[model samples]
Target: MYKGERMVLRFSRGQRVAHWALAVSFFVLLFSGLTLMIPSLAPLAKGGVARMIHRVFAVVFMLVPVYYALADRKGLQALITESFRYDRDDLLWLLRMPRYFFGRVKGMPPQGRLNAGEKIHHALIILTFITISLTGLVLWFGKGNLSQNEFLGMVMLHDIAMYIMVILTIGHLYFTFVYGALQGMVTGYVNEKYAALEHAKWLASIKAEKTADGKLPQSKSA
Candidate 1:
């Protein structure tokens, strides 16, 4: 894909590391969860193996955010702040989601570092993670320490969180694969053309800052 074209840093090394770590753990949990919840999937892992694997990844999933914050507090803070903010363009982006889903992004509104769909995805993940973590803890440690009603409530909440998480994860994968974003996560960089097209505003801000600092020359990529 590199034909001497300029490139942009779409993600940092730390960001990529944390993202992949969390993604891997999430997929493991998803598969194990499928086996635990469905009898037909039990052949995927047997002898309590799936549950053991799920627990191990659950710990990693719970810690990935803490690791990211410790490794790059500023980056994590910026991401969180952006995920909570919305604008007119965000609304437009969502309205035009059908086009995006079908790979017709030529006329979409310019996005920042994280696009509208990404912000929605992040918010959902955050919400579900909190709910799932709470319910998971209850299921793990509340055995015989709770009433039947409380136990059933926790189990129901946990199942609901998993449903949300699984659906979101599937959508995330679809967009990433369709848009060729996997390279950005793997290499921490993306083609300049792609970034300018999808995240023009964010790319412009970076260029402006670099120009102000006299650290970048005035060029097509700039």
Candidate 2:
């Protein structure tokens, strides 16, 4: 088994469970949603299976936000709150991040539990969920007689949203896989070195918690 010291519980068991549930649902929805996007692909006969799985997982996806809010309301609030106080240092850090990719920025900004990029990504996801849910509902069960033109408009909107989401999802997957950032979600903990380097402010919080308890908090290392 993997082991580590100076770790913190970034996500509770409930949060991790909810995250995985949503992730699985997303995969199902993505594949199923794709089948509907291309008319030529619809005639392949397996489109029905894809639609069925997508609809089932769409329902499951709804539980994610509920669980997250109930399980950790405080955390959720922190994640959503937008802070407007940005210093010149923050600007410098933002500009410098690209240098990190080229091994130029040796010591980047001491980030908080969530970095600026992560926060932006999270916000985009919230928007995506709202758009997808609303548009999907109209496609699935909207009443009132609509002209073919109106229906096509909704279909076009849904397709555009899905394509945008897919692009964002690809970026997310690249970060998680290529950069080894998925450990935070997969194991509920980040290594001390990683936390210190990437989330220094968060590491301070963990240290404070450890000091209060006189022991390190439990965490699963990837």
Candidate 3:
């Protein structure tokens, strides 16, 4: 609503903070974890530096969910709910996903707040997070107790989960830049037009929440 541009609150303050914390902690973990895995990157782990970094950020990484839950419980709930729900428009949208990949967002099927691809992405991230965390815990705490085969298996699962998340994060970044989505996360707001194009159903729902006096309803997703 500033500068005469009608803006929509795509995220809230709590959400923005949580998003940045997650992003920062994720990248740190990615690099440190890579250092531990790749022989060529072994030097980067000099004197266990990378291992220390990885372990420390793993704590931060796990704490992010708790922070998000406390800061914006309703928003977290909404996101989880939205990320699992899909409809017919989502099917049509998937068929045209290539157009979206190339930066075309217009004239596609109307989407909800989290679109279909986004839902899939979030769902995958959630699953991988669980996989990585559980395997990571076993590998960390069960070191001396676990047999060689069990240890190796846990390590394999942990690495696979990390690789999958790395791939997803790269795609996430690509789409972020292609679609210019950074602003929404930074400011918790987005242009109405953009919302209409990328999240028509969500925008309509938000707009419909407006009161008779023109005030937005009390909502974290306003």
Candidate 4:
């Protein structure tokens, strides 16, 4: 029998706040950005309302990194570093993910603070944010004196970035909101039993810390 009690505060209050800001801002960007893609929706994007809303949310989204840096500098650094580094094991895990979906793998890889899927998603979000911000600035500032080719290129790039973000957002929402991860964010506490089953390595570390000191361990890598 597992001799461990399982309860965890996954996200702190500050982190939760930052996540909400990022989520809301992304939604606003998605809706307003979509108008630019569909000409029939152009009217919805006009009159500066959508543009203003987009800019406001854009600023909020940009501040997620700033707040994360200031709130927990070390944790933020670790998250960035760990989210990118992938071992051979992680690649193998990706290859075997099909087994997981089919319930053939009895146990998944021993995930660290974040799993392979989370790392991939985080990396994609970071890349998309950079791409959108750069392309958005070009369009926002009015591509003046540029050739039609240059203008169209920026537009196409921006649209592609938006599409990527939208797809990721859908996945994120489905996994988090629809699949119960949202509770972890909303309450900051995850079901211990669930953690033990889904995140055995992390649960073990938590139990170890609890055994040493009647408190949960601070995450080495958030």
* lDDT by residue (tens digit), candidate 4, 1-222: 222444577677777777788888888888887776689989998787888888888888888889988886776787788779887757766777776545443456766666676778888888888888887887777748667987888888878888888888777775564336777788676767657555667678877987898766643312
Q: Which stretches of candidate 1 lie over 4 Å from their true place?
A: 43-47, 216-222
RMSD of each: 2.6, 3.3, 2.8, 4.1
- Comparing candidate 3 with candidate 4, which one achieves the higher lDDT? 3
Q: Sort by TM-score, best first.
A: 3, 1, 4, 2
User: Candidate 2 on 1-222: residue-level lDDT in tens?
Assistant: 224555667777767887798888888888777666678767643737777777789888877888888888776677667333344545666778676545443577876776665665677777877778777788778636667887778778777777777787887786666557787798787777777767787788878887999876654444
Q: List the residue pairs that clash in candidate 1.
A: none
Among the numbered candidates, top TM-score falls to: 3
**TM-score winner between candidates 2 and 3:** 3
Residue 78 local lDDT, model 1 = 80
Regions of model 2 farther than 4 Å from truth: 1-4, 44-47, 82-91, 101-105, 212-222
Determine the C-alpha RMSD for candidate 3 after optimal superposition of all C-alphas.
2.8
- For residue 120, model 3's alpha carbon misses the true position, in angstroms, by 0.7
Q: Considering only N, C-alpha and C atoms within 3 Å, which residue pairs clash in candidate 4?
A: 6-192
**Residue by residue across 1-222, what tens digits does model 1's lDDT show?**
335667788787778888999889988888888897788997977888887898889899989889989888887888788888999999999999999999987899999989999999998898898999888888777878989899989989999999999999999999988888888788777777787888888889889988798864323342
Q: Which stretches of candidate 3 lie over 4 Å from their true place?
A: 1-4, 211-213, 217-222
Model 3: per-residue Cα lDDT over 140-219, one tens digit each: 78969999999999999998988889999999999988888888899888877778889999888887778455876533
lDDT against the true structure, per candidate, is 0.85, 0.72, 0.85, 0.74
